[model samples]
Target: MTTVYAAASMSLDGYVSGPAEAGFDQLFDWYGNGDVEVTTADPALTMRLREPSAQVFRQLLQETGALVVGRKTFDLTDGWGGRHPIGCPVVVLTHQVPEGWPRPDAPFTFVTDGIEPAVATARQLAGDRLVGVSGGSIARQCLDAELLDEIRIDLVPVLLGGGTPFFDHLRTAPVVLDGPSPVIEGDRVTHLRYRVRR
Candidate 1:
């Protein structure tokens, strides 16, 4: 069976990105600085290590064998940098397939509007491998479409008063937690894994 997983970093106040997704945007300028700690606790992490929580969860996402993203993120990512935090099939959900976006050498296809369509495309592309949902709007679309099988959130400690949020301005049904597992990475961040029940 094909499984869909959505992973995100949320804050203590339930804001994943912040006003218009600013928290994540703030990270774009992280400048590989090891001094700024982005996690629940101010832990130690060198440039050698990205976000500990992201590293661990990215490993899981790699298992997906395929990934889907929205055009905003894809275009921002230089036409979706190859395979993401890992090298997996990536399908960008967009109406416009811009030229000269510096696409990765790897296989990166484009899907039209909607998350299910993207998931369907990924499933067809993945064959028997798992599918990953990475990005804000795409994830929300998945949730709205009820196509996501699971969601893993790594609650970070950073505080961004405003930005794009993971779960915002969407009407979602009741969801329960599978459980909580803790992961500590080189004193950088502590990741709490939660199984999101559909």
Candidate 2:
């Protein structure tokens, strides 16, 4: 079986976005370690924060065989405008395609149905490399369906108090958890890699 990796930079308090999904840009900038420090929370989780290094990120991107994301995450990414990263197959999960929505001419496709179908399709497209689960709910659903293989969390050092969470209303009874190897980038962020407990 191929690996399914999730790369994220969540707050210290466990929030993925700020109120109304406002801080996501700042968060990604932090993820890319772009020209911003984005969050201002306690640096206690420094050891778990993921640092930005295009080489490192691209190395992981090279490992990405396909992309999976929820409607919300897909919309947000589309709003950012430009090209999708990874340059692999992108499977977007949505109930209905948005009106006037401009799908990327690249290999991106929308899945209005469910995950298993998407997974099977992505698997066929993935070949030998791994597939990546991009959105929070997508990750949650994958975990719920026992489809995810590994989770690489970029635990940034910030506490936005509340926003979107990585794992919401999730029951951890099925899967197991493993290794939190550290991938420290700067003095600020650290990337923690975990193997799904199965």
Candidate 3:
């Protein structure tokens, strides 16, 4: 069976970016310790600390067979350079399809019907592998539909005073989670894995 999940870098205040923050670079700088460019740090030391998480991230990319995202995220990322970063099929849930989208032999599938169909198509493409759902709106839709199986959040220590949040407009009752307590803490971030209890 394929498992569907969402993973993202979030701040202490639960915002993914600051208001009017362009491109969310600050929210995602922890991925490569890119902010270190402005601070004093040995290149070798920085790579040493970042290597472990980078390896794990690569493994996840290898395991993902398909990705699902909302139209907003698709537009924000410019459609991942016309190929998904995971190198798998990408299903976009949107009200209107792009003019030049679904190009010949492209890895994208635009679904305007609804979220359920979009996720279903991703599951079919994923097979026994993992289906990655991203963007706050799409993930929240999955949560509401009870289609998500796990949530992997990289809790960054930064405090984005205001901006888009990780979870917004969710109406479902509290969902139970089963995983190791305390989560896995790294140098600059904490990795949390939670299995969604149905």
Q: Give the per-residue lDDT digits (tens) of candidate 1, residues 1-198.
A: 688877766665566567754666434232243444333111332233355544664457457778888888776867534545445678888887767533556678787666777899898887778888877788778877878777766666577766667776566856565766554442324455656676
Instruction: Provide the overall lDDT of each model, using Cα atoms, as 2-decimal numbers.
Output: 0.65, 0.69, 0.78
All-Cα superposition RMSD per candidate:
6.0, 6.8, 5.4
Name every residue pair that clashes in candidate 3. none
Best by TM-score: 3
TM-score of model 3 relative to the true fold?
A: 0.86
Reference-based lDDT, residue 141, model 2: 82
Structural similarity to truth (TM-score) of each candidate: 0.73, 0.79, 0.86
What candidate 1 gets wrong by more than 4 Å, as runs, is: 18-47, 50-58, 80-83, 100-104, 181-188
C-alpha lDDT of candidate 3 relative to the true structure: 0.78
Error of 2 at 19 (Å): 1.9
User: Could you arrange the candidates by lDDT from highest to lowest?
Assistant: 3, 2, 1
Judged by lDDT relative to the true structure, which candidate is superior, 1 or 3? 3
lDDT by residue for model 2 over 131-162, one digit each (tens)?
88877788888888888888887676777778
Could you tell me the C-alpha RMSD of candidate 3 in Å?
5.4
Best by lDDT: 3
